[model samples]
Target: MIVTWAFGHLLGLKMPEEIDKNWQTWQMETLPMIPKQIGIKPLPKTGQQLKAIKQLAHRKDVKEFVIATDAGREGELVARWILEWIHFNKPVKRLWISSQTNKAIKEGFKHLKPATQYDALYESALARSKADWLVGLNISRALTVKYEDSLNAGRVQTPTLSFVRQQEKQMDKFRPQTYYRIELEIEGQKALRVQNNPYEIKDQQEAQNLIEQMKQHSGTVVELSEKTKTENAPLPYDLTEIQRTANQRYNFSAKKTLSLVQSLYETHKVVTYPRTDSKYLTNDMKKTMKERLQAVANFAPEVKEYIKAGATVKQKAVFNDVKVTDHSGLIPTEQRASPAKFSNDEQKIYNMIVSRFLTLFANPHKKLQQKATVAFANERFVFTQNKVIEPGWKPSEDTSETTVQWQKGQKVRPNFSIKKELTKPPKPLNESTLLEKMEKFDLGTPATRAEIIEKLIRSELMERTPNGLQVSPKGKQLLDLVNPSLVTPDLTKKWEDELEAIAQGKFSSNKFLKQIEQDTKQLINEVKQSQKKYQDFSLTQKECPKCGSFLREKNTRDGKIYVCSNSECHYHRRKDPKVSNHRCPQCHKKMEIIEGKNGAYFRCKFDGITEKIPNKKDQKKKMSKQEEKRLLKQYSKPEEPEEGPLSIALKEAMNKED
Candidate 1:
């Protein structure tokens, strides 16, 4: 058997112009450019690898092939596309396995399934690719051309931006409400408020009346209850869950976390695949649990404690075959990894996986809970406290201490106080909370969510702020102009559900594509008939002299730049002043470099002066012998030069100075 690999996607769907000549220009007449059939072509960068795959397929000795890419939807598409492109009619088998450990590979080869079994997965992937092409191209062009500015709209990116804008709108319309709560103190223990369900009073007078009635009143402990509470150990880490935790704990962006975890998987070979959505391990993996634990014992010393305690018992919560999908949850491999070999970021991700995997074998956290209720007049005040009985899996759990003894019907004097509380608005969406929202709404798959969020930030529709994510002015305007259905998550989520259904063989890919085509036409019509106008929020005050169009300003690390807003006009220039080594004669400071119709020159903005940049070739050229001799004869003999008109003028000037 021969083993080969591809660089992610070796072939991509053909561009609009490559598919049809009519869609070459960005005109409204070609709006909603949907091809009757979408075709795949080889990507430029992987041409050599693709050629090699083709040659290997045609070799006489190679009779059968095995597709051992990632065992997921996208992976199926990758191998299938390559095989179809090469016109290979040989028998094909699939090596589907979750983890890449040596044992798993050996087992996968023994049970390789026919590649035809994954046809539904390939069909689903193909349908999604075509839908995105049709919708993304048609809508992006329509918006950009109609607005005369660079605008981007997409099925997933547009809705993701809308989530930010929706959150911003909620914050803008929020009103703060003031309320009062009554608190009591007894024997130095703060008494809680239980008379009001939420312990809040909207009326200040009502609060004052209650305080006047209860002032100087004696309280009795009417009820006392104590019970034991146990919290189950948390399940192992999924990609989204770890991303959320990393974001909150380390302030790492979702993309950064994914990149780090991917490195740990691909480069370090310590963690399993990082793109899994399941949180449970397959039952068959239970046999390898001890070895996996022993592999991380060096890096995470605590794993040894769990192993000694026999904590690796397979609980139904952590090990179940039904919950696992194409890949199991991310976990540590059986290969031992040295901590010193990993980068700081890689170490962080690797530790997270090892830590979460260990938790599966830990005991349930146990705590003692006590609640005491005291009554002053008709109002009841309650106090609750929890003490950790056993730290269990979470050794870092905070333990609350209590020593006071209380009996039912005991009398005591209580101090009452009124506190004012104000309701605050929701905070802006950070990456941590944003991932949670995306997962909750099914906006994108675990593997694709990071990319979708990055696309929004890269396109400038959303920006990262110190507080959280905020919608740009362009993003807000996009929400107002796009078809209303495209702005909400429901529509896209429905399509995602259908795609999953297609993968399950319960839905038809052709039907889904036809629906997408109809939807594309309606979206295009809405964009065309809208009376709303689009304003270029990034436009600068400067205008293009050649095209008479406004110049759009963009910030870069080097400096700022101004580009012509007109799509047809190719005009752009740097806005920052270029400081040169040449010094200004008046200011004696470095001069600004400027290129003009005349040539390169140095300009001093403060002194309002300009100097031509001298050519080094002219200055360094050697003078001929004839030219040197002529100059020497003209100036060496003053008596011969005084007779000449030019020499007489120079002598007159010298006599006047004397």
Candidate 2:
């Protein structure tokens, strides 16, 4: 059998202009550009690859084809589209396997299934692509034309942006209330407020009185209890879970984590598929546990003990066929990895996958929990602590044990103080938190979630800051101006449910596309009729040099740029001067090259020093007296130390201390 591959889909759905000439112009009259039938066209960049595949299919010796792309819906669509585009009528077989290990691939070819079995999956993928085009492109066009602004609204991304906006709104309106709680410091352990009726004082005077009263009265232990608690090991890493963990731990974006994991899967072949949603393994995979563990043990000798202990483990939660989908939870393959050959990033991600897998076989974590309640001045205060009874899977856990000997009705003297705390607002949604919400709502699949997040940032609907992800002013306005349904997960959830049904052959692709077309028309009409006004929030005071139209400041990977607000005028330039190779003699840093009235010049941002770039013929020219005087005058003023918010806060704190 001949093995062939295509770099993703060589042919994509036809563009609007390809379908009809009218769609070349962005007009509300041509809103919802739903073609009579969605057509396919070869993408220009991958045309050569497509031609090679076509040539291979046309060879007389090649009697049949095997679809061996990714073993999921999108993968199925990729192979099927290529075959259809090539117009090959030969018989086709499929090789579906979750992992790319040599054994799995060999077994997959041995049990190759017919291509017809995956026809429904291809249909589902087609329906998704068409629906996204009909809804996303049309609405994005409608909003841009109606408001005369660069705006993008989508089925999944808009809702995801709405989540960030909602979180920001909650934080904006949050009012912090001051509450006081009195804690007793007895033998270093601070007593906690008891549940049901916490010792929280709202009034400062009342809190002070209670603190004084508690200090006078001798405290007595009213209740003491001890119990054993067991926590089961964490389930294996699904794609989303690993993404979240990596983001929280290393501050890696969802896209970055996915790429790293994909490299570990596709390039190194050390792990299973990186795009699974399930965290459970199939029962058949249980027999391969020993070999997989031995491979991991070779790579990470520290986990060898866990692997050995886990080998005898018969944990029911580790394996469940019902929870698995197209692929199982991500785990190390039977191939032992060579850490020295992998990049630092790949090693980090690989360790996370392997670490999670190790936890699956180890014993449950057992701890001894102790609680003590004390009554002082008719108020109850409690303290609870846990000591590990068994390290189990998490041997690195904090197993520090502390013994507190306090019997019921025992009298004790303790000092008390009131702690003043203000209620805190909810934190902004970072990539990690946002992915969790997206997964909870089923906004997108594991493969598409990272892309959906990136689309929002690229569209400038949301931005990442030190605090977390926040919706831009344009995004906040888009949420108001767009159809309300598009900003909620409900629409995408409904479409996804139907798409799944189509994949199962319970729904028709034609009917699904028809419904999407109808919905697109309705959404477009709503956008066109809405009287809500949109302002270019990023509009700069300057006009475009090319078209005299107002230019909007847009953030890009290469820093900021000023793009003409007028949709027709595509004039754009970088907002800042380009940094040149010339280094500032004083600071040894790269200086920005600017075009001055004289000629090209280099300027240092630190001390406002400037230097003229001499031409080749005038390379020996020395600095003139006037230029020397200007430089001295520019640096004459002594620079004051910058006082930012942190500095000012530190000053205020010092004043308070004084």
Candidate 3:
């Protein structure tokens, strides 16, 4: 028997606080927009985690150390990296499981994979860490120092930034040409198209001309076809889909949602493996679905209700043996969660995963899409409508927040009433779609997608303009200066394909590492040798009023600020509008500093007004009398006779007054 103790991921490294004093400083941000780099910082409490891991290793009864993280590349990385850092040298096994119930964990342990089976996975994972360190840190620091601002950069972020930047360029070049579309009302109801599709008039003038012609002509009914099409149930929630739906519903950033979901997975133990790419479960899981459902009766009332009613689980969409890869899609387990264990966001994510899983074995949400064409005079129009005939697996009760508490709800069916027609093109990529694209490109996986999105935004290499995430001027410029491949998501796709080959033992890890090394060498040379034109928009010269010398305005954490280039010259002023710090009367804490075109000013960061401090000379004069009084008072007191120089100054000032 292996002396195995299960604990969370915090056991292997330095506490996030001890790792940097700036951890708390950076935490002051409203969001996780940490500037600098995008790689694993290995969270706080790492040392404690290592102690736990080592403690397990030291146990005499433990025969084999099994690395049982979430089942994926990231999972492998988490456990192996922890082991490596902690000097755990023992025969290791991989305890593979999806949902962490007693049964699932036991089953997983019983069928533990040979440690050697995932050497490729571990290699790829380590390579990713090292690569991110090399590229993300260098590029991030270069940008931050060059700009004198804490700008973020990363392997994934640069490509994401490029996406936003490209969108911006397209928008700038866009000419919003007016286009016209026509809709016809038949009797009281609006008609779209019968068989032929609705028409879009590309030219407004042509559309007007056609409208004029249609007004005179009498259009015959060209064709009318009405058939029901079924919209199958949505596939189960994978990490990507979960992030996507979370973004759509909650407006949470991709990274934020991922964090929430990760917490739900690791903390709540109610949700399945979150970092999976697959949305389908394995064939074997179908047998244990009942047990899994029974296990989650506390957190997921729906599961209990369905089970009590003896409703069978539906299988086609959510679970397919063929679709299951390294891991299956996310699902709930029997690890009972108290309501206290979850935050609001965690509960929401948990609900989503559980609902999708329950719905999968239950039924398909079936609706009949009916299309009809209504013609007015000679002008033809098309009309379409939907009628949900059967909510197969998707009982209305399951969809409703209030449960029906039964497998089958009332016999009510879906009815459709649709009118009006408008021609609209496919919408451009939103965050969710962009993240979906990321999955395809392999720029980042499900775990890294949100992190990349956020990293790009923090760097200002990308921006979320009114339209969407687009690359910024800085991002594009950096892409031009740096190695093209590293800055592009395309490299990830290529590497992932190769890594996949390696995982299957098709390609050698050594060969892959060699290629990465060669590529990195080439990239380094290109960055070093290139004489690219670098520009700082802030460095635009502004003449200083005090010394009649040009002062360089640099962007700082407090925004743009002017500082004299000559180190000896002590001229400095705020560039971006910012109020200065003043001690608040109530809290006695330093106030916020604000800068504007006029100059820097202080305002109490606390909820109160602040007294202003004037120029250096004025401030010195005001403080001089007070400082002298303090010196005199100190000398008069016999507290310390060691008050030598200050006492002499006090005596001289006192004698002059006398």
Candidate 4:
């Protein structure tokens, strides 16, 4: 069997200009430049991969092929498109598995499914890619032309920006209000007075009256209750959950966590697929659970102990075929882990996955929950306490507290006091919370959400602040100028629902594409007709030398640049003076090297100092120790030499040293 791979996508939908030259220039007349025939073009970088696949497919010995790319919708597109482009006539089969364990691979090869089984999935993937192309390219071109600035809009990205903008609006509109709460200490146990709205006593006078009454009267324990509860071990890590946990624990961004986990999967070979959306495993995988446990025992001895203690899989909680799709939860593969061989980030993420996997087989956590209600002056107060009965899967925290035992009809004196507090505004969406929101709204899949967040930051539409992600001025303006539908997550939700239906064979791709086409046209028309105007906030006083257009400041990953505002001109220049590794003699800091008409010189920004660099030919040179000693000896000699052969030899030596 021949093995080959495509460099991501070998073929992509043709650009507007590739279809017709008239559409090349962005103009209102070419507002909705929809292709008459949506043709596929070979990507510039994939020619070699495509050629190799074609050569191998044409071999007489190769009768049939198998698609063994990632087990997801995008993976389906990555392989199917190559075959379509090459017109490979060989019958194809599909290899689908979750974990990269040898056992899973063997089982997958033993039961490879026909490629026809995933035809609907390919259609869904194609529909999504084309829809994004139709909407994103058209709308982005329209906005850039209408606004006269380089702006972008997309089905998923816009909605995500809208989420941040919505949060900002909420924060701006929030008004803080002061409220009072009464804390009562009864029989050395703390409890808070309960009301219709627990701590929101708006009237200060009413709060004072309640506090005075509670201080004077003795309270009685009117009701007491206790119950034992069991909390089963949490399900294993899905990509989103692990990303969230990593962000919360280590402040690792969603993109960073994804990168680390992906490295553990593809590079370290210690973890399963990192892009899976499911949190449950298939029932068929249960037989090899102990073996998988044994593989990771060295990394987690506690888990090994649990397994040795007869820990068994919870069938109902963990093993469910219906809940799994494409791939199972993120897990440790049967490959033995070498913690020292991985980077710190990889080790942290790997440990997280292993911890979750170990917890799945451990016992459930048990706790004793207690509640007491106290009554005084017709006011009800409630207190709750929890004690761990068994620290099952996870390590238990100490919850023991000294409290007076209370019973029904018991009397006790209580001291009460009131504290005033102000309402707090809603917190900004951090990467973790934003990811959760995206997951809830189906804005993007697990694999794409990190990229979406990164795209927003790269576009300067959102920025990372100490508190969380904040909308930039440019982002706010873009939101105001774009159509409302594009900014709302509902559009993405609708598309995702339809795509899932197509994947499940309940909906047709052609119908979905028709709807997308219609929507794209409407969105473009809205942009063309909108009354909103966008001010180029990045515009600078400097003008481009080539185009004589105003230069606008733009930021790149490397540094900032000033570029011509006119898209066609595309004139760009560095904004900051280039720094060189050559150190300054005075301050010893790296000096900024500037080139001029005359020559190159070094300038220091810290001390406001400048120094000239010597010409290479005239620069001072160091002499060797032997040459220095010889020169010193020659200089130390007397002016007159003795009239002898030895004196003559000494004179010659001195001349040579000179």
Best by TM-score: 4
lDDT of 4 by residue, 221-320 (tens): 8889999998888888899989999999999999999999988887777788889899998887787677778888786657677678665775357898
TM-score of candidate 2 on Cα atoms, chains taken together: 0.87
The CA lDDT of each predicted structure is: 0.85, 0.87, 0.63, 0.85
Worst 10 residues of 4 by lDDT: 616-625
TM-scores across all candidates?
0.86, 0.87, 0.69, 0.89
Runs in model 4 deviating more than 4 A are: 203-205, 399-402, 593-595, 598-602, 607-658
> How many angstroms is residue 24 displaced in model 4 relative to the true structure, after the best TM-score fit?
0.9
Question: What lDDT tens digits, residue by residue, belong to model 3 across residues 1-658?
Answer: 6444334444332323444465433322212222332334345645665676678787777677887776777778777767766677778888877766566678887898788898878777766665555456445444444444345556676676666555556656665444445556544445532334334445656655655666565454445454655555667788888888887887667877778877776666677777888888777666767766775566445666767766466556565778887778887776656767678888787778777767655555666554444344555455455556676655552322211111211121111122333444334456887887777677777777887777666655666655556665666677666667766788777877877786777887667666655665555555445666766444556777777667776545667668775544789977644544446667777676665457656677567564555888887666655688998998888664576898899999999999
The TM-score of candidate 1 is 0.86
Question: What's the lDDT of the predicted structure labeled candidate 3?
Answer: 0.63
Which digits, one per residue and each the tens of the lDDT, describe model 1 over residues 569-608? 9898889777886678898888988888987789998896
Question: Among all windows of ten consecutive residues in candidate 2, which has the lowest summed lDDT?
Answer: 192-201
Task: Judge candidate 4 against the unseen true structure and give its global Cα lDDT, from 0 to 1.
Answer: 0.85
Write the residue-wise lDDT of candidate 2 on 1-658 in tens digits: 6666788788889989889999998888887798888789888799888889999899999989999999998999898899999999989999999878899899998999989999999999989998999998999899988998878988999899999988998998998888877777778889755546343567778878867777788889988999999888888899999999999999999999999999888888999999999999999998888889888876556567756565654456878899998989999998889888899999999989988887777678999998898988687888788899898887888998775777899997877777887878899999999999999999999999999999888988888899899898998899999999898999999999999999999999999988888999899989988999888789989988798988889898878988898777889878998887677889978898777777779999987788887776685476655788999999897899889999999999999999
Residue ranges of candidate 1 with Cα displaced over 4 Å = 195-206, 399-401, 555-559, 577-658
